[model samples]
Target: MIERVLAIRHDKIGDFVLYWPALFLLKSALPKASIEVFVAPAVQALAEACPYVDHVIVDTGDDKATSQKFIERNYDAVIVSCSEFRIYKMIRHLDSAYKLAPKHNWYQHLYKHTADAQYKQGEACWRGGCMLVEHFLTQHGIDIPELPQQYWDLSAERQKWRSYYGQEGNEKLIFIHAGTGGSSGSLSPSDFANLSTNISDKTQVDCKFVLTYSGAEEELAQQIFDQLSKKSIKVVMAKPLSSLADFAKSIVAADMFIAGSTGPLHLAGLHNIPTVGFYAGRRSAPIVRWQTLSHSDRRLSYTPPIGKRTGKNMSLIDFNAVEKDVVAYLDANYA
Candidate 1:
């Protein structure tokens, strides 16, 4: 009987959110056990907010200190989701009977058992990584379910956010983020405004647009807002979110979210809000890899043509296609 477990994936936002399903599996497989997570300092609050995790340890920059925290946890199982060699070495003496990770470089030999899968064109990071976690459970005679049983009970937050936003029953709320064009390119400010205007023009339902952006991207966000304001349709700049938690709370009130394959898009996906993600058509950041990890039926992902991989051509992605699909989603859900 596993009484305690340790999961390590000290990484960035998109990287961190990818592990939610695996964490779900762990909590479900051993319902009575305590699940502890080691994540980066920046995401400590996000990890803490997850329903599955009982305790969160922020990664200490000091190696000895990090190892001490791991040893202190008395975990019966360990799951390594990060590829850092430092992480592997820190857990070298994990007293756990089970250790699982993906089969990778010679470093993978460190794990007692490894999941057999390669990160390739056909495989998504979340699915491939979850395979490692799944293999560990199956070996121990635990059944892997067809779908992940994980979602935050954000109903209370949603209600409060709804009241806070003063959302009436009629209008469809859409949140948009146009940043770094999925980190591989840039979608011009004019294009963002055009898409916003098109959504309003195409949708029969009354629409509201919230241009969400971080501190650094305020100017870009403002530029999009300025462009949209010039149109007859209404667009508003989102109030500064005090923290990631704040942004997450606000997402609960959204009808649809649109973004390049950026961090906030993943944040909204975690909430299972409908999302439309724009992705680059590069092998390293393929549509399959960076697609918003949401409920399959709730997301629409668009990638440029095979030859149009460069950032300069991101505008070539059809606004008509985006508007049509988004309006369709709005029609189905809200109309």
Candidate 2:
């Protein structure tokens, strides 16, 4: 009988967030099951806030930590969403009834049972995650079902975040993440400045842009704020967010979010926030791969023409086209 479960996905931001449906399935299959998430320390807060998760264990891939994670507790089942070889090796601790993981190599034999994630070259990431989760549940005699765009319950936090930011008025608030986090193309501050003004011109509703960035993005934010200053658009540099939780709160409080395919974009998707994401045209990193997993109608993904898949090649993403879509999306949804 499955009573306690461990779900592991010690990966990056978007990668970790993509496990929404799989996690949902785990809880659904075993509502009374004590579900714990094993994630990188980077996403501890986010995992903690997950309503389906009962506990959050920060898995740092060290030998000692792995032993402690495995030996310290008794799990009835184990699920691995991360493809790290070492992570698979640490499955020695799972003396459970079921161990569900994606079969990639000989190392996968470590798990008593496994599923094929069937990763295609340009597959939608969230779907692949769902497939693995579904494979596990079905193989274990559970049926798969539909899932929400995400599973975040931040009602209390939403109110608190709004009050903290102060409810100024009905002015639409669009959170813009201007800096690259080593994951996406670097849209220059000037490009964003232009986008802000273009959005203002395109949207019927009066909107304000809140520029949010990580610790390393301060200088980039400054440049964006300075550029926005050149225009009449009402723009504010968001107060420095201290953690991933704080960042999520800010997204909850915003009316819309704009960014490249980065962490906050996925965070915004988790809350079903309307988002316009800029993506590259590379086959490996196509729009379908990391498209924001928000409400289908609420998400807009824009990609450049297919060409060189290098960083410098990001400039090929037609900024003008993106601006047009942003305007149209807002007008269609909010207008």
Q: Following a full C-alpha superposition, what root-mean-square deviation does model 1 have from the true structure?
A: 2.2
TM-score of every candidate: 0.92, 0.91
Clashing pairs in 1: none
Candidate 1's residue-wise lDDT over 1-335, tens digit each? 88988888898877777778778888887789998998998888788888888999998699898898888888888888776788888888878788777778788886777887566676667776677778878888988866552365576677767656556668777888877634434677888888888889888888888788877778988999888887766777877768776777678877788887467777787788888877776646656676666777987877666564453377778778888898888887888
In candidate 2, which residue ranges exceed 4 Å CA deviation? 119-122, 155-160, 309-312
| Candidate with best TM-score | 1
Residue clash pairs of candidate 2: none
Write one digit per residue (lDDT tens) for candidate 2, span 245-265.
767756788778888647888
Which 10-residue span in candidate 1 carries the lowest summed lDDT?
A: 303-312
The per-prediction CA RMSD against the true structure, in angstroms, equals: 2.2, 2.2
Clashes of 2: 0
lDDT of 2: 0.76
